[model samples]
Target: MKTISQVSIFIENTKGRLANVCGLLGDNNINIKALTIAETPEFGILRVVLNDTEKAKKVLKENGFIAKIAPVVAVEVSDTPGGLAKALKVLADNDINLEYMYGFVEKASEKALMVLKFDNVEKAIDILQKNNVSIVDDKVALGL
Candidate 1:
């Protein structure tokens, strides 16, 4: 697992908004490691972990998108029933507040990727290490 810069974009809750934002990143060659869209009636929060975070943010901003960058931990956990529960318990024991989270598993794999937005990142990292939580780097995640 590793600490990555996550870009959160506030977009209007419309069909084409997501496509436009994604297209901008794609055009700039910023690979999205993980992404999720949490929508309400008025707006949507698009959380993205990108390979080129700065570039993505710049492009988004130039295109009139409201974006913010923050540090998040990308963890690779087992894709089992209690996998997320185990991780959440570790954070809870340390009193780390999880602001937001998103993830997905590789097709046909037992491993899953999780992006955790927490209150105290360093503390959370220490807690995870103390609890023997394995973190997958970019290379490890992509099997590169």
Candidate 2:
């Protein structure tokens, strides 16, 4: 899989807070590829993989949202039995520790596109590549 930038925006857990973030992106024509929301009593984190990260972040900051970028891996896993287990085995063998991960499928051909966050990204990528795993490019991951 390829390494990509994941943008996490801090959003207040209120009625229209999420709506505001979505509206901002919608108005700017930015497409969100993969998203995961983690929440607490006070706030929520909107983790997104965007088609245009730079512009999205800039606009979010201008609107007073706290946005940060981090590296994450994207892998196109098979849509069959043991697909995910097989991939995870590769990382386990290589001693790669996964911090967190998320994914989605764009079509019937594939079941999942894995987005992973780990400390040793370079090593993890090298291992996956050598094992012939399909790694998606960060820019391409945005699916613009």
Candidate 3:
């Protein structure tokens, strides 16, 4: 629900390319908090919410990977039925449109973190705040 920085890395859709990215990050001590890959026929877009986004981008670019930074929203919601529905409903009611989103469950946790991309980030954050949603900024999201 709060705006955060997301790094998008475009890499070849071939074996070892993903490993190359991971190795590069690991070697530089960059930590990935959340990640999702959108793959097509020839290429893949790796979207990552990281503890060190600028460094990650630098590492990727130095290694010849196409990397860019963008803003996204991260929300922590209850890990139960209708938890997502309620959050989405708030956005829908506020006329906010989500371009895409991804998330993961924390092992042995009762909450899930969802990373959201939207055309209207500030407006979405405001709405989410008023509704009492757990909105996290980039640092907070990475810490989670």
Per residue, candidate 2 scores C-alpha lDDT tens digits across 51-123 of: 8889998999998999999988888789788998888999999899988888753531355788888899898
**Candidate 3 residues 1-144, lDDT tens each?**
257788998889999999999889999999877789999989999998888877887888888888889998889888899989899999999898999999942422468889899888888888889999888665566764
Model 2 score (lDDT): 0.84
Question: Which has the greatest lDDT?
Answer: 2
TM-scores, all candidates, are 0.85, 0.90, 0.90
C-alpha lDDT of residue 51 in model 1: 72
Taking the tens digit of each residue's C-alpha lDDT, what string does model 1 give over 23-141? 88988987776888888998999998777777887888898999999888878678889988999998888788988888843522467778788888888888888898876665555
lDDT of model 2 at position 99: 85
- lDDT of all predictions, in order shown? 0.80, 0.84, 0.83
Candidate RMSDs in order? 2.4, 2.0, 2.2
